[model samples]
Target: MKIALAQTDIMWEDKKANLDIAETFIKRAAEEKVKLILFPEMSLTGFTMNVEVHGEYYETSSKNMNNDKSHWNFNRTLDAIKQLSIKYSINIGIGYIEKELEESKGKNKYAVISALGEVISNYTKIHPFTFGTESKYYCGGDKISYFNIDDFKLSTFICYDLRFPEIFQIASREAELITVAANWPKARINHWVDLLKARAIENQCYIAGVNRVGHGYGIEYNGNSLIIDPLGNVIGNCLEGVEGLIIAELDVDLVHNLRKDFPLKKDRRESLYRELAGEIIESIH
Candidate 1:
């Protein structure tokens, strides 16, 4: 499948401006006839923990964990996906803040919507950086999710989720492509590059990591968006501070061939892994 990754500059804490920029990119990708286009994490608003300032009142009244009746422009993001999909006749995946559940103190939730404009599934970030009150502002997602688009099985993950390898494993079991949307900074560029390739090699799946560029809340980012092939090669990438579309063609045959040759699934020692997981959970509890 041909997918276009948008590596663009964000409008810090400004939802409208970021949406405008994203729209322009999406239009361009459509003109190029890209089947799927991805946007970076928190694309509507730059990564900021000021929930009180940016968070919206998301309730059932919103009809889909979003209430546009309250003048929530962020809610329009969902509509944008549906409209874009219909207009361009392609699938689009973008990240945004959702309304919170009652048990959670935070009003913001992180979610990824599909081309049909339906929220295929939503993942509250499991690990929130405590430095900027992310934990206080956003609820955490408990489990990993996977979905299918045409012939390819795929999964979605936000920033900070990359540190955990097990999550990738969970998705890899069913997905041939794992798409990670992030706001990762320039300082950890190495980690981002390494992890994307590692995930492809270890899981035998294509890895598409879409990260944003520009500065936000004193944090500067150099968008190193990448599309890693199943054999663990960087096929397409954007360098530091560059903003544009990184298109790559991913073939399902490679993933199938690699898994058949390596057979990591059949070789896994689940019994030993259960014991390890038990020990870790016990220690945390």
Candidate 2:
């Protein structure tokens, strides 16, 4: 399948402008016959902590305006994106802050929309960036999610989730390609690139890391969005400090063949790891 990573420069808390930019990228990707287009974390809004502005309401109407806040105006943007995806006949993966009716707080979520305008997979970020104080405003998700597109089994994870390999290991059990949407800063960009390669190498799957460029919340981002194959080779990259699309074709057979040849997962000692973890927990108690 052909996939495109949109390394965008998010307008700070400006939904309409960002929506327009996102559409432009989606259209360009469609012209290349890309099957899936991915955007960075908080694609519409620069990583802002102000929930009142960027947070979505539990129940929102595209026509109704409860207030003038950007959060309340997200439904309209979502509707527009859905229409664009249907019009272009392309799948889309975008990130946003979603508010649930059952909970008072919102969660960082990545929504995967099919070409037919159907929401096939909605994954909330399991690990919020605590160092950035994201945990203070958004609730963390508890589980990972996977979905399929034709012959490819795909999964998604947010920015900080890349640091945790256990979830990737679990997802790799069923997923051939994994997508990561991030708002990572330029200061730690080396870590981002290294971890992405590590995850792909360790899991024997394709990894796509889509990150943003430009400055946000007083921090600058050097877009190092990348696509790595199972052998940890970078098939495509957007490079640093550029707002553009990086396209790559992924082969599912490569994943299967590499896993079969390496057979690393078959030798995992899960029982030993669990016992050691239990012992550590007991000692802490």
Candidate 3:
């Protein structure tokens, strides 16, 4: 599968401007014939806390999540991206705020739309960045989610979720590729690459991490978007501190063959880990 990492310069809290920028990137990637293109977290609006104004209503149960725009809270960002996906004949992985009725907060979500512009996998961030006060405004997801292209399955995750490996490990049980859409700051970019390498090596699956570049909320995000192989090798990078695209051709057969040769997942003790964790939590109490 040929995929693209679109490192973008997001306009802070501005959906319209960001969408225009995203459209240009989409058009460019389509011309390159990229099968799937992934954007950073909060693709349109930069990592901002202005959800009340920017948040879009989502029909959590709808099969055609992107096309069903009848909800009064639905916004233009969703509509534009769906049309872009269909018009360009390509799949898109984008991030947006999903307003939740219960908390009046939202879920930081990454959703995948098929080439036909049908919603495939709509994943919520499993870990909200409590350090950044994201937990106060967003609810964490309880499960991992995936989308398929033919027989190839790719699990989805968001920014802070990458710090927790347990979810990625669980997702790897059935997925060959993991997509992490993040807006991680420039100061801790080293951690980003190192963690991604570790996840790819441990899970024996391809990791595609797409991040944004430029400024947001007065913080710098130097895009070090990468496509790493299961062997923990950095096969693709779109240059640091700039907005660009990294194109990579991933082979699922490589994952299958590598796992057959290495057979690492066969040795994982899931129940043992759970038992140990349970005892730790009980002891703390």
- List the candidate 3 regions with Cα displacement exceeding 4 Å: 59-71
In model 1, where is the ten-residue run with the lowest total lDDT? 100-109
Pull out the clashing pairs in model 1. 62-66, 124-141
Over 50-109, each residue of candidate 1 has an lDDT whose tens digit, in order, gives: 665555543443455444445433456666667767766767777776654333444234
**Candidate 3 local distance difference test against the native:** 0.89
lDDT of 1 at 188: 89
Superposition TM-score, candidate 1 onto the true structure: 0.89
Give the lDDT of residue 42 in candidate 3.
96
For model 3, residues 198-254, the per-residue Cα lDDT tens digits are 999999999999999999888999999999999999999987898898899889999
Reference-based lDDT, each prediction: 0.79, 0.89, 0.89
Best by TM-score: 3
Q: How high a TM-score does candidate 3 get?
A: 0.94
In model 1, state the lDDT of residue 30.
Answer: 80
Model 1 deviation from the true structure expressed as Cα RMSD, one decimal place: 3.0
**Candidate 1 at residue 31, lDDT?**
83
Off by over 4 Å in 1: 57-74, 101-104, 107-114, 283-285
lDDT for each residue of candidate 2 in 1-285, tens digit (9 for 90 to 100): 999999999999998899889999999999999999999998898787876556663334334545545534345445666898999999999888776434556789888889998878888899988899999878899978899988899999999999999999999999999999999999999999999999999999999999999998799999999999999999999868989999999999999999999999999998998999999999999
